[model samples]
Target chain A: MKYLFSVLVENHAGVLARVSQLFSARGFNITSLTVGETEDSTISRMTIAVDGDERVMDQVKKQLNKLIDVIKVVDLTNVPQVERELVLLKVNATRQTRSEIIEIVDVFRSKIVHVASNELIIEAVGHMIKIDALIKMLKPYGIKELARTGQVCMARTE
Target chain B: MKKTGSEIIIDTLLDEGVDTIFGYPGGSVISLFDTLYNFSDKINFYLVRHEQAAAHAADGYARSSGKTGVCIATSGPGATNLVTGLATAYMDSVPMVAITGQVASKMIGNDAFQEVNITGITYPITKHNYLVKDVKDLHRVIKEAFFIARTGRPGPVLIDVPSDVQKASCEFKKITNVEMRSYNPTIKGNIKQIQKAVQMILHAKKPIIYAGNGVIISGSQNELKEFVEKSGIPVTMTLLGLGGIPTDHPLSLSMLGMHGTAYANRAIQESDLIISVGARFDDRVTGKLDEFAPHAKIIHIDIDPTSISKSVNVDLPIVGDAKGVLKELNKIIKKCDIKNWVDYVSDLKKKYPLSYTKSDKVIKPQFVIETLYDLTKGDAIIVTEVGQHQMWTAQFYKFQKARSLLSSGGLGTMGYGFPAAMGAQVCNPDKLVVDIAGDGSTQMNIQELATVANYQIPVKVLILNNGYLGMVRQWQDLFFDKRYAGTCLGRQKNCKPVCAGPDKKCPDMIPDFKKVAEAYSVKGYRVDDPKDVKSVLKEVISIKEPVVVDFRIEQEENVLPMVPAGAPLDKMLEHGLS
Candidate 1:
């Protein structure tokens, strides 16, 4: 099963390495991870997606909590969440293919961030499914380059 | 008064009630050493020859004294040298704080000479670590290091302070308490789980207690004994868990694991309920996980939540300190009717006693261990390096109290005993401290003899001089068709044209250990006959200065009652000859 955890850690050097090292060293599979500063400057918030069985995920949660730099770990998978991921892709878009690519981007509520004579750099933001849908729609145009930020999330109700 | 970072370190240490420090000076830590020199009267700092010994010594001190041990080292190589010791302490959950000097702040990432990111390197091994770039954070970092090391599931913590921080000046402020919001350990076990354990233990026809280091760490020996007596349940200890209960106690199964006693394994296999306290169900103790305690429902009580349900699933897990949970269980529990179970385990114990194949000519390592135990009346603090002799000491020496037997059980580090004994003796001047060493391991840190002699630490290094790394050889002999590779300590390296083949003419022994001891100004003795083992140990134990006794034991002797790795408990080789 997949589990998403929102971890609050000490905002200092090497905190990221410590969290990632725990996953790698303990053999926990990290599906995706993103970190950024929280409201408090001294604390950093990390959104981590882990893939493992119930037992493995339980252990991973306990082990993450064991790290001193890790302040708190909240299982956001079951909680009502507004998870978002951002992806940027440079697709081959000749003058003939440009109008069609812009139409597809518009349908997905995405934007063409950059445009050259032969390519269009499309920017995407939404649930992971929407991002995957956008990439699938643009696959025919030949994706010359692609970059993604691991999902970041917050509780939906709050 | 304003003080340099070095002075602040000394002040904080004094505030923490640290009496001794095991450290070696280097260029990066020159300022800290100078400050320590001026404060020598206030704190005792032993100048170790190697940074590794400093860390091991501190670990030994921590394990035996039940206090958080401290060691200091300089940057780069010196800091790296402490890695093995830190890992050893970490694996065994020994409370320790290691302070290492780093390159100056500005030169940290520039790859300056002797500058390494020690905190980054030791991330996996240490429970917590800090790199103090700011001078004012010195007190806070050191204070946090000690607190993190000694609290909850205790383990080693490292603090890497840059060279400039030690020189930078700041006002000394004492941090009495470190409150880490994310770092609170569960101390009290849940009433529901305790009740479940109590009912299971009371109702089970054949219940056994499997305990380990947590019992000793919690100082729960008396509580364990009381519970054992009240429940009429037999107890088995892990290697590191020795001395948690006296071996002579009728209910005490000396140790259980790969090289554990035959009866202990039998009891664990047959038991209907296994109450695991403080033990993490290490692979060594569990044998083949699939077949481990097949008939038993496990109740695991450990302070560390991560330890519960790690290797073996627990029917009930009580996440609390051993002492506290045992205390609570004792309050509401009535005596259990386990007479039949107790008698059954007792019968097994007598049926398969720990008996060695005796060699009457040259000394047997078991004889030396038995004689040493008899001579010391089992009162000595016995430390051992890793190998067959270590297993022998664990088998033969009946430890009667907590912290009586100290060895690198988890990491299995060789050369741990000699310096560890020194650290134990430094803290306990009146107690008899002995390091039962293998010839291969003794040579690893023989340079520490100078430090031992200079201070006259009265530590005895009893080398079971077998001319081979006996443990690995035993494995090869049993499982690998006796193809001895580099296990022989005296194997001639890269044979000359005129040299003989590997098997026939290798020198039996390398350096004469007695001469090595003498060269270091420490007294030395060598005994080749089994008959003289007792007298030699007796004589050495009475010596006021550090001494090394080399007992040239039968080289082929192997630790017995071996459970082949990944084999079931029932598959132990009760007697190799049989």
Candidate 2:
């Protein structure tokens, strides 16, 4: 099973290294991770996606909380939540297929952020399934390169 | 008041009620040492020959006194030397604060001289670590180091301060009250969980309390004793938990696990319920996890939640300090009726008691320990280096009090005992501190003889010189076909360089520890005959100075009642191949 954890830690040097080291040393698998400064500059929040069962994740959660830099850990998997990932795709586009690609982007509610004679860079932001669907829609045009900002999540307000 | 980082560090040490510090001077730590000179009246410093000894000494001090031990070393090699010591303390959950000096802040990443990422190196081994790039963080970092090191599941915490930070003066404000949003340890067990534990204890017919060093760490032996008496449960302790319950107590089953008593193992395997308190089910304690205590319903009580089910599955877990939980359980729990179970286990004990070949012709290591135990009346603080002798001391010495037996149980570091005895001796000036060492392990940190001689620290180091690394040799004899490769410590005259090599230095004396001791201006004694063992140990132990008594016991002797690795505890080899 895959588990998502929202970890709050001190925003300073070696914090990320310590967090990642804990996973690596313990043989836990990190599927994807995204980290950035929180509202307060002194604190950082990391959304870590891990692959483990209930027992392994239980250990992961407790071990993460044991770190001095970590403030709190919340497993957002069971909570009513919203998750989003921003992905940019560069597709091979000839003059003949340019309009068709734009039409597909418009249908998917994405944007062509960059354009060239040989390529069209499109940006899409949505849930993981929606992003996958957009990529599936764009893959036929020979997707040149792609980059993803791993998933970020928040609990839905009551 | 305005003070430099060095001054703040000394002030913090004093504020923490620290009277002694173990450290080694180096290029980067010179400034700190200079400030220490001026504050010598407030605090005392012991100069260790090696940084590793400083760390072990601090560990010994911490384990003996229940106070966080402090050690300081410089960067690079000095910091690296403390690595083994830190791991030793970390494994045993000993409270220690280790401070390392780094190169100036600007040269931290430039690969400057005497600079190392100590905080990075000690990440896994330490409970927490900090590298203070700024002088202002020094005071708070020092305080936090002490607090974290002494908190629940106590462990070593290192503070790597750059040289520039130590020299930089600032208006130091001591942090009187420390409350961290991230770091808070649980002290009290959950009421529901305690109730569940009580219910489980009441229902189980054959219950045994497996205690560990946590009983001593929490200073809850009295509480544990009360719980044991009230519950009427037999107790089996780990190697480090020898003193948790007095060895002579009717309910105490001595020690358990690998190299433990055969009866204790039998009891655990046959137990219907195992009430584990303050003890991790280490691989050593649990042989062949699938086969360990096959019939036991485990209720683990530990402060660390992760340790509860990390290795062994538990039916009930109460996460809190052992002393606190034991107290609560005692208040609510009633006496158990396990008279039949007790009789069965007691019969097992009689059937499989610890045995050794009695010989007046050769000195037996077990006999040496028993004599020492009788002479000290089990009142002395007994420390041991890891080997056959360590196991012998753990077996023969009937510890009567908590914090009375100190050794490297988790890491099993060989060189830990002698220097650790120094720290124990320093803390308890009147109590007799003895290091039951082996010939191979004692030489690891033997240069500490210089420190002991200079300060006249009366630490009796009893080296069971069997002329070989006894424990490994025992394993080689049992499992490795008795080839005896690289295990021999002494060689006869006219030895060939073919197998030992030209540079191996297989000397006739093997540096002859007695001579080594005498050169260091310490008294030395040797006992080759079994008749001389008692008189020599009694005389040497009474000396008010450092003494090394080399007891030349029968070579090729092995510690018995041994369970081979990966085998179930009950399937133990009672006697060596004669």
Candidate 3:
């Protein structure tokens, strides 16, 4: 099962190495990771997507929690959540196909962030399904490049 | 004044009251070393031949002194060199803070020359580690590293500072508190478990107490004594457990394992109840898991849960601090009588007391160890390098005090003695420290002789010189049809074309250990007479400076009470011939 976890750690050098070291050491597969300072300047929030058995993830949590710098860990899975994945797709756009691409983008509520003589950059933010659908529609137009920020999720309500 | 990372690192070390650091210099750490050079007037540094030596030396310093020892290295290979030492400190729970320089931040992930993931490599072993990317975090990280290293069930911590971080300037701020939620180390034993353990000790008819490294690590000697005396249970310690109780105590059986006293091994085998405290039933002690103490209802107490019943079955397992557990065990066992049990075991100890025969009447390694124990009266801290010398020291030396015998128990690494002895001495400077080393093993870290001399640390080195690799030869003699293949450590392997000693050209080069000692300007002597060992040790220990006593013992002598690697602990063969 895949679980997304947010960990707040002391913003110190080598903290990332420590976290990645823990994951690699225990053989836990990290699908994606993003770390940045939170609203609290001293704390860095790390969003990590990991896939493993429940027991292995539990071990990961317990071991990671043992680090002195790691302050807290929250599993964001199964919470009434708004999960978002941001992806940028660049595709070959000819004058004939430009209108067709715009029609496809309108259905998915994505925006064209950039345009050039030969290409158009389509930016989309939604769940994995919404992003995958956009990619499928653009694939026929010869997608030049694809980059996706792996799943980042937040709780739905106050 | 705005402090650089280099200054912050030194200032924190100074605040921690660290007086000594073991290290060698290189380019990445030069600025830090430069700062150290400025502070050299106050702090002492021991320049070692190898960074590994510095690590082990720091380990030795910490284990003995009960303080966090420090070591430093340059980037890349210098940092990697510290890995073995850091792991050693980590395994033995010695408090050490290893400082290493890294390439500049921009150069880190670039795989630039002289860059390695030192912090990454040490994650599993270190209690905690830090990398100082900026000067601002230096003071806090250094303080935190020391606090974590020495606080509870102490272990090594590493701080990797990039070259830029070390040189970068920032304001100095003192950290008064560190809030760590997940890093809480339990300091107290569980009351319920303690009471249960006490009940088990108090009610048992034939209880044999087994002590391990935990007893010394937790400083639970007094509690151990009270429980043993109150319950009248005889105590037998593992190799790591030596000195938890006085050797001459009626209840104390020196050590229990393959070559353990016949009585201690048999006592556990026959006991109705066994209270094993602070020890994991290592294969050395539990020979054949099924046959080991089958009759005994076992109560195992240890701090680490993974250690309990991991190898042998246990009737009761308690996880908590050894000292806390001992205190509770003492409270519950107010009074008890095991006169018969004590008497029976006492008889076994007296009759077959650990004794060996030296057929040539030459000074035996056992003789040197026994005499050393007698001379020091077991008050000296005895550290040993691994292999035959380690086992021999365990068997022959009587440890009458706790934390007095330090050796590589789990890892059993060779060259552990000299550096570990240094650590032990650093912990308790008032006490004498001795490193019992073998010729081959000592050579591995023999370079520390300069460190000892430089610091004027009075750590005595007793080299048990035999021509061949004794332990391997013993196995070969017993199991390999005496082929002696790859076991002979004679000069034939690398004979000297010409000798350098008083005698002219000789076929062999026996590591002029005395000359090696003298080269360091330390006192040295070779004891060729077995009869003179006692007086020599007595006279040597009287000296204030570090000295090496190269006692030449019989060549083929093997340590007894052999369980032959794969054999069950219960079925240990007492002697090679037997």
Candidate 4:
């Protein structure tokens, strides 16, 4: 199971590394990790995605919550979460396949970010599954390049 | 973003998840103490009789609870007093954070009355230490110190807060995270190395697994057992490694050192392959390195890289977490033929097992310890005091699980048992917690009986009442001519004299342990007869409240299988392979 947690922590050097290190040292698999300053300059919000059993996830949450710097830990995995993943994929599209690729991108509401004589760069923003499926579809079309902004999630109501 | 000193210190502690601190009040740390008092409702403070006890209590809490233990002390003597406790935690790798009060900024290094460079003194033992000179940096320094203490190979970390800094006000900003490039702990085991280890185990005809404290510290008992079960290797544990494998398990050989089982010693000597996990080849275990497991091809696994090849040489050294490495090794070891190796080790066990002779002259400490095993069946956790009693308990008591035998193994702290037992009981309330102490060692921390009584902590204490310092006597008996020196309890310094005859006027100062227990309003039982010792221990441990049993025994009994000072493991006498 995957868990997405947004933690509010005191802004101090090494705090981010501390969380990541805990994950790495414990052998917890992290699918995505994003950190940035919050509205309060003194506080930083970190979104971490981890895969583990329920018990392990619970322990992880409690352990992270026990850190003195952590003000609050909000698990956004189940609470009507707004999850977004951005991908920039360059696919080989000659004259024969260019029109078909454009039609597929239009169906997914993606935009053509860049275009060359034999390649097309498509940018899409959605949930993890959508990005994964898009990557799979583009693989058949010969993906020339790929980059993904690992999952960043927030509470839907907030 | 900057904060004042006092708030920052509290914030850092809060960040470190410290809810309880054991400490003593003093001059230099008055401000910190005052702040602590104000925050009393939120952060708990346990007042201790001495600074040393505070440290031990913290260590006890950390060991059982699996959280960083916190202790606070004032400057100079208070700080110095904590050295023993810090060293104990450091040696055992307990996660602890010590807060000390330093002299005022201007007063420091002026030959200030209460000022001492605590950080310098604790440098060698601590995982890391800091002296917070500036108030603004207090919070960050404390947060970072806590981070270092509890992470990687966990150990104690100290922070000396100047008195003035505790008074200086700062903003209450907390540090939520910490990142240090040089501090990353290695997590993954090298696949190639693990595969090689598997291959060695498969081909070896006679292989034995030498387990150590590393298995317990890494929390990898399951992994160790899995590896052993799959590889069919016989396992021998060190004194500290006793509980890493269930002692009753068919392949489990209780301990492998000075007093290790005969089968374990023979297995190590004759085995073709040796797998040492999370244990250093201490002189006690490897008497003469050249003769120690000379026939075995050694494979050493530990989280600390330096531990590899430090004492005995290693053919295959895997540098990673014991649990992680064992997990990887288990996967690869699944396809191996270790049946012959297992049978060879089992044959050794059948030939020369761990059996002791019952003495006809006096009550042996080993017998009393074995009684503890009979009563508890190695189910309860056993804590012990230093001196001959500690070694005897390690030799005689059978430990069936890890974290079950909590003693001052590395520091050999004499007064450890009573308080440590009390602490262990706090963590394991339902399980029976017993402390086995020598007469000399028990008196060192007997004051903690009050703590045990006050908390209503049902800790069973078995004081092996041998009137002399037994270990010292053993050394004298071995090295010096049997002309007794000051090792006797009737010495002038101790202000006591034995009643030898009717005419002899004995010193009026012998304190009866039963009376002492009565004074504390705790139950006391005395076993004068050797025959009744086992029944008395069973009754005491079975009770619902704290019970102390003083079993007076022969004075000169020594812990056998001892290697003389600077002797090698294979050179151990009294007991070993034929």
**Candidate achieving the largest DockQ:** 1
lDDT tens string, model 3, B427-542?
56788889999887888888888888987889999998876677877787778776666555554644444321212232443677889999999999888888788888888899
Question: If the candidates were sorted by their DockQ against the true structure, best first, what order would they fall in?
Answer: 1, 2, 3, 4
Predicted structure with the largest TM-score when compared to the true one: 1
lDDT of 1 by residue, B1-578 (tens): 78899999988888888999999888899999999999888888998899999999999899888899999999999999999999999999999999999999999899899988899899999999999999999999888888899989999999998999999998776777798877888999999999988989889999999989999999999999998888878999999889988999989888999999999999999999999989999988999999998999999999999998878888999999899999999898888898888898999999999998777797988888888888877798999999999999999999999999999988999989988888899989999999999999998888899999888889999999888888888887888777776687777666443421234455657788899899999999989988888788878888888999988888788798999999998899876734
**Residue range with the least summed lDDT across 10 consecutive positions in model 4 chain B:** B500-509
Q: Give the winner by TM-score: 1 or 4.
A: 1
Could you tell which candidate, 2 or 4, scores higher by DockQ?
2
Candidate 4 has a TM-score of 0.74
TM-score of chain A of 2: 0.95
Tens-digit per-residue lDDT, A1-158, candidate 4: 88889988878654665566567666987888878799989889888989987766765775566444577889887899788988999999999999999998988889999999999999999989988888887788999889888888778775
Kindly report which residue pairs in candidate 1 clash with one another: none
For all predictions, the C-alpha RMSD in Å is 1.9, 2.4, 6.0, 17.1
Point out where model 3 deviates above 4 Å: A1-158, B295-300, B305-318, B423-430, B491-509
| C-alpha lDDT of all candidate models, in order | 0.90, 0.91, 0.81, 0.78
Winner by lDDT: 2
Provide a comma-separated list of chain B TM-scores, one per candidate. Answer: 0.97, 0.97, 0.92, 0.91
Alpha-carbon lDDT of model 1: 0.90
Candidate 1 docking class? high
Which residue window of length 10 is worst by lDDT in model 1 chain A? A51-60
